[model samples]
Target: MTESLATTVRVEMVRGRARFIELRAGTFLSPRPLNVEGPFARLALVGRYATLLAGDDLRVEIDVGSGVRLELVEPSGTVAYDAQGGSASWSASVRVGVGAQLIWRAAPFVITAGADIRRHTRIELADGARALLSETIVLGRAYEDGGGPLRATMQVYSNTMPLLVEDLDLRNTAHRDLPGIIGRNRTLASVLLVGARPAKACGEHETLLAGAGALARALAPHAHEAQAAVDASWERWSELVEGRAV
Candidate 1:
């Protein structure tokens, strides 16, 4: 039997506070919301198929209502195993309402040797919404040759204006060494901050010649940088919304 998982989470403002109002998970998928003392709530993923298998399909959807703040975290990394002649896929879709904020700190996604996979991320934000997101992709396991084909796509938009869009199709390890591409790097890290305008400070696309730990180190500073940008944008937007600034 082919394995599949689907999880959905929704956050909304209740009595002037953000709370998780709805959460659902399918087979082999688990979503746990941790009790952290702050305006932002943390969500952890616990599952049996964090490492996907052949013919596996996984989907995650998250929605943040107006004035809500939420953070998402993965306890561990996700690995795509060799599917022999088959393939696997994982996708996530996020929606942020007006005046909402989201911080998604994703763990590394490793493509093991001989694995064929496709990953996609789509985020839509309303006017006055802000988000800080990060992702890391590792080509293969440590001390081993790289993996098989991996096609990844990402699209971020605010209302109708496109903030960022990327479509990468990597067939094999050779593609990683190509100039202007990964350039002999096995890991690729990306951090995006979307708000009033595109956060150009966080718009850096560089390949990293390091492992997952190094990627995390590289992402930490960028995450903070992105948060700062988002905060600034929020202040500006608030001023405009309140008619204090033209």
Candidate 2:
């Protein structure tokens, strides 16, 4: 007789203009090959979620399973400068991206949340030339009022410096209801941004997100337009917070 094992895998990346995130459980990513065998059931899995804000300019891929395969591809943009006898001027605009993926499974249930951010800008001119961007998201059926006990998070990244990464593992839904984690909230969310946004803009963004109350309400009766709202929320949190990366 042999004892079988399960595995979980996660791969994430953040850079100049592209990002990719992926994860899968039931197969716990481990040194030993992940193989789970049960008398009545057997489980196997793999997948990924990627976002390319720059179409035709950036590409990324994630092949997830008991084994994880993560990749990112980005086509750089340009910055030009010119001189006109007495004065010189320069202007540039670059678009970046932020992405994430969460894999949830039951029977021992596994929950994972992944995310990434990438963007850049250049300007050689005026006194108050400015730009801004951000991302945020709250996941749950706040409207229909649904809740769950499942929780987990996995994220990874690398750049010129040491590299930023976050692996958040949440457990005990009842615990999350404590005084800190989520307080009395039943929503899960993340936000990212670029440049700077006015206080009014920030306030408005949050107000708009009030509609994500129900996962079903999040969905557009006409079509699945909730993605737009979800995306908006995620970007709002993109705002940089002073803290150590986890």
Candidate 3:
């Protein structure tokens, strides 16, 4: 007989995406209770291999303030929100999950993703919270021998919507064929915020981030903006996590 008890993974938003993500990937996390304080929300995801898709509901228990507990059943195809009142609402068609998979010859990727984003969260709140960050990294070519292939993708989502989606597939062949794609082959990371303050807010995101790069080489034209963007979001996220309404 296969030695099996119950395999499950548990995660909690001890601080949301601002400071850190508290994730417990294992079997014993289930049937457990969370009594912690400070914006605590327990996430219970089932399945031997965790992947957010249809039919998989991410069971969530959140308590923001007061003594009331909010229970949310986040189906892979849906996202739900509950207030201090017992009232609950859900998104129509969306898939949100946190998972890790091993890809060949590249660093293992941990993806917190939500597809069909429009289905979850109210339109106002979802759009208000999303940052939609992208990082396209072009490898080193300044040294003549540094230009090469690279692959990595780190993604995060909110309200069953994509907040940060970093996709990097840099190959020498693809690099040479495209212009304005990866001009100098420099690594680019960019952070986009939905609710940025003055000087950082721009109706058009790309233009704003790109224009900021014109003043420096690190953020110059190309895919490297991706990395810079991601980093900036983390800082901004940290600020948001620290109780600052974003």
Best by lDDT: 1
lDDT of 2 by residue, 138-237 (tens): 3233242222322232222211111112333333444655665655543333332222222433322243221111111122221124334446444333
Which candidate, 2 or 3, would have the higher lDDT against the true structure?
3
- The regions of model 2 sitting more than 4 angstroms off are 1-60, 63-146, 160-163, 193-246
Instruction: Mark the regions of model 3 whose C-alpha exceeds 4 Å error after superposition.
Output: 1-9, 13-37, 40-144, 151-168, 174-178, 192-237
Better of 1 and 3 by TM-score: 1
Worst 10 residues of 2 by lDDT: 103-112
By lDDT, the candidates rank as 1, 3, 2
User: How does residue 120 of candidate 3 score in lDDT?
Assistant: 21
Counted clashes in each candidate structure:
0, 29, 17
Candidate 3 lDDT by residue in tens digits, 1-246: 112232232233333321113333332113233343443333323334343233333332211222211122222221212112222211212121222110011111112112211112211112222222222333343333223333434433444444444454543434543675656444444443332332444323333332111011133433334444444444444354233544
TM-scores of the candidates are 0.78, 0.27, 0.32
In candidate 1, how many Å is residue 75 off? Answer: 0.8
Model 1 over residues 1-246: C-alpha lDDT tens digits?
265657888988877767888888855557798864334667876666555788888788899999777878788878888888888888989998988878776777888887889999998988788776666677778765676789999877778666677788897657667776656556666555566332122223322222110011132223234333334433443343333544
Error of 3 at 50 (Å): 24
Model 1: worst 10 consecutive residues (lDDT sum): 208-217
lDDT of each: 0.68, 0.24, 0.29
